[model samples]
Target: MGSIDKYIFKTTLASFALVLVSLTGVIWITQALRGIDLMTSQGQTILTFLGITGLVIPALVLIIAPIALMIAISHTLNKLATDSEIIVMNAAGFSPIRLFRPFFLATCVVAALVAFIGAYLAPDGMRRIKQWDAEITADVLTNILQPGRFAQLDQNLTIRIRERLPGGVLGGVFVDDRRDPQERVTIIADHGTVQKTDRGSYLVLYDGNLQRFEVGKRDPALVAFARYAFDMSKFSQGRDVTLGIRERYLWELMWPDEEDKTYQQLSGQFFAELHDRFMAPIYPFAFAALTFAFLGAPRTTRQSRNFSIGGSVFAVFGLRMVGFACSVMAVKTPLAALVQYLMLFGGIGVGVWMIVGGVVVEPPPRLMEAINRNNERIARLFRRPATA
Candidate 1:
């Protein structure tokens, strides 16, 4: 609320925004590339590919928001230290806790955004991605409509055509089915066409010979037919959206459909997901506080705190990894979820205490300082001329 708070708040927020957009954009492009085959190989347009890929941004943002907050807070503090602004503030009788106000506020803001994304935006985006993928998969014929090439429709079906004739006529058609364990089927037809109805789609072959061969006995039995209908249902079966945990909304994770046996079996995953979503928002504040406690406090000397910064990063990263492990462990034991809270809030409390307490939270631990000094000495020794 004060001038100092507002200044730090603006700087932190700006840094976070820049980092968020830049990181999200870089990562999103890599992920979106995975879907490029939809446009290149499949019949999808550029807009369709972009639309489906763009839906992924919300999920990426949820992952990046906390990290951006950490970087932003650290950057602003380091910049202020470099400019001697932090020293001026300390000279002006401002405490570390007072200086932490704006950074804390900024962290809280990012945390809330993460919570919202996890609850609604991320889940909704995931659902959209699923639906889009399913739609693309179900339309198998449309996706694999290339003429004069063999197209593998499913695990055991392959079809090739000499050409696609006008008026939906397929010329020089060859279809093979090997899905059955006991027998293999091959159908050769001079002409064929696909029929899609409300009930299901069918591939009708005219003037074709159907060959069936037993797996153990290879002598084939052949039957000639004027007309035969092959079901396409297997290629385009509808997927049950409820089966996917990421597709389910937050409420569904908390209170799932009771009658579903799969949900009962996967109860641990559901609880884990619920706890993770709720806990993601809390990380920003904890990480921000801890980082500031390590790197934000003022010192009379203008010496670099690179070691302190590295230690802070590793410490925070280790904590984040621990939280990740806790989420996995919580799936098996519900009590593990409590460990996340203890670690997060405990780190927060310690960080704040370091800031407000009169005694110094050393810029770098003595061990870390000693390691750096030793490393520098080794590097200088290695660089010196060996035999002058």
Candidate 2:
């Protein structure tokens, strides 16, 4: 690569990195806010809250990288034009293909990043999210024991505490077990804590009494005890982590087990996910080409570039939206997947042709005139009345 190419490549890559981080951070904050219960109501630590929320980042980047790349390409191209660098390069016989090399290289890097995240990292994060969430919920339900609320740990089991004390002690503990239909057992304790043994989890209560009522007997029996261990193993049972189609790794999607229940039920979704991963990497390249085709042509300062910039943004997002629609439909109609490929490659092919042909894309003169008229009216609204 020439010096100029290296400069453009570095500039675009840096801009992409900045935009990706800013966008991801903003969106992640929004998602993380929804999980604030992990720390507030769930009795979890801040680290635990952040860890669970951070798991969604890989998936976010997989969706955001192509858009960021487009923004970065547009920024770089506009910067060059603003400084008259593109005009100079054009006058010096620098073909659009030569100018495009650096942008393509930057896009290649972003595309590879997207591919890796989609194929492995994103799904891995999702799997970990499920596992961590299950473990946290079980821990909270069985161990943490929320205060002042009757927590339904199981369909037939409920527990509550008046207050949580330091050193993992629960005060004024209440346990109601109705798992046995033939009898009902209620236990009241002054203090208690959940303990795990080799056998399983147990709620060990201090200074408690248990009252039991059998199905055949009308009278209830009360047993007083200094200490007792109530088996909580049933309430703390681990949930089966069932991942959705978006949570499956690329290999899992590509070679899905026919006998797998999810695969059997959502076979079309499996197909869509597989093709979506395959197409993820291609979007960055197509977006870069399209942005370049719209704005890379040299133009004098007298000519406006806003229309071209808007056109590129619209084209990039429109194509992506179509691809998304195709993905959704592809879940039912397998052939719908082909439309994305056509749109993607068609954009790339046309973009490359326009770039090489030095096509200066602009809106129709009548449209520009109407836009100018609207702009003048809006500007008049904002303008200050001549210093009265």
Candidate 3:
């Protein structure tokens, strides 16, 4: 790599990093907000909330990196053109291929990053999310300890508290249990506390009475007691965690087990996810090439690069949208997945042709020019100062 390659590569990488971070931060904020109740309503700490929600980031970056790379390329190329750096490079006899090399190397880096995220980080993050959810569900103290609301431990058992005071005291306790076929049990107490141990969690009722009713008779039996303990072990039952196609590793996705409960009855999604992981990493390279095709050629005019930028964006978006559609169809037909490969190659082949042929694909300038003239006219009318 020459000094120019290092410079362009460094500049593009810095811009790419900035764009990726900004876009990912905006998206992560939106997604994190949806899970804010994990702290507000679930008695969870802020760290817990952030950590749980942060697990989705790798998957999100997998989707955002390609778009960011494309934008960074357009930005860098446009800046170079506007400053006449591209013209100087062209006059100095720098071929398009040489100028394109640094960006292509950057594209390779982004592609590798995408592949790692899609194959490993994303799946590992998903697994963490699944594990976190499972842990939270089994945590009675954190998940079901909300004050002044009825939380059902099971279909037959529910517990409520009027107030969860400071120092771990519970006031106005109510318990309803109907697991027994022969009777229903209702317990109310003035004060109670929820305690956990190795054995299990238990609701200790003080100065309370249990009212048990016979299933078929109206008469009920009241048993007065100084203290009673209701076993709440059932609430913390550990459920078996099942890994889905999204959580599976790359090799697992390639050779999924039909008998695996996680993938059972999800054949369409299985194949689709496998192909998507493979296809996702290719988009970064294709998008970068497409940008080079649009803006790599030298231009003498200082025209706005908006048209070129928009055209590149549209092209990339169209290709990706088609790839996604094919992925969906591939679920059922399997053969439709080949369209993704075609889309990848077609983008690169067309981009190479345009770059070699000195083609600059830009949006229609006439439409934008007309809109700009109308805006100028409106501004002039508003600034006439006749009213003064």
- Which numbered prediction scores highest in TM-score against the true structure? 2
Worst 10 residues of 2 by lDDT: 136-145
Alpha-carbon error at 381 in model 3, in Å? 10
Candidate 3 wrongly placed segments (more than 4 Å): 140-146, 150-158, 162-198, 202-231, 362-388
What is the TM-score ranking, best to worst?
2, 3, 1
Model 3 lDDT tens row, 272-301: 899899988889988998989887888766
Q: How much is 52 displaced in model 1, in angstroms? A: 1.8
For model 1, the local distance difference test gives 0.84
Best by lDDT: 2
**Residue 115 shift from truth in candidate 1, angstroms:** 0.7
Mind giving the per-residue lDDT tens digits that candidate 2 earns over 199-269? 88888899989999999998999999899998877667666788888889999998888889999999998
Q: What is the Å distance of residue 31 in model 3 from its true position?
A: 0.7
lDDT of 1 by residue, 200-266 (tens): 8888889989999987785899999999988986665566554477667788788889887768788
Going through the candidates in order, what is the number of backbone clashes in each?
Answer: 0, 0, 0
Between 1 and 2, whose TM-score is larger?
2
Worst 10 residues of 3 by lDDT: 162-171
Model 3 residue 198 distance off true place after TM-score fit, in angstroms: 4.7
TM-scores of all predicted structures: 0.75, 0.82, 0.79
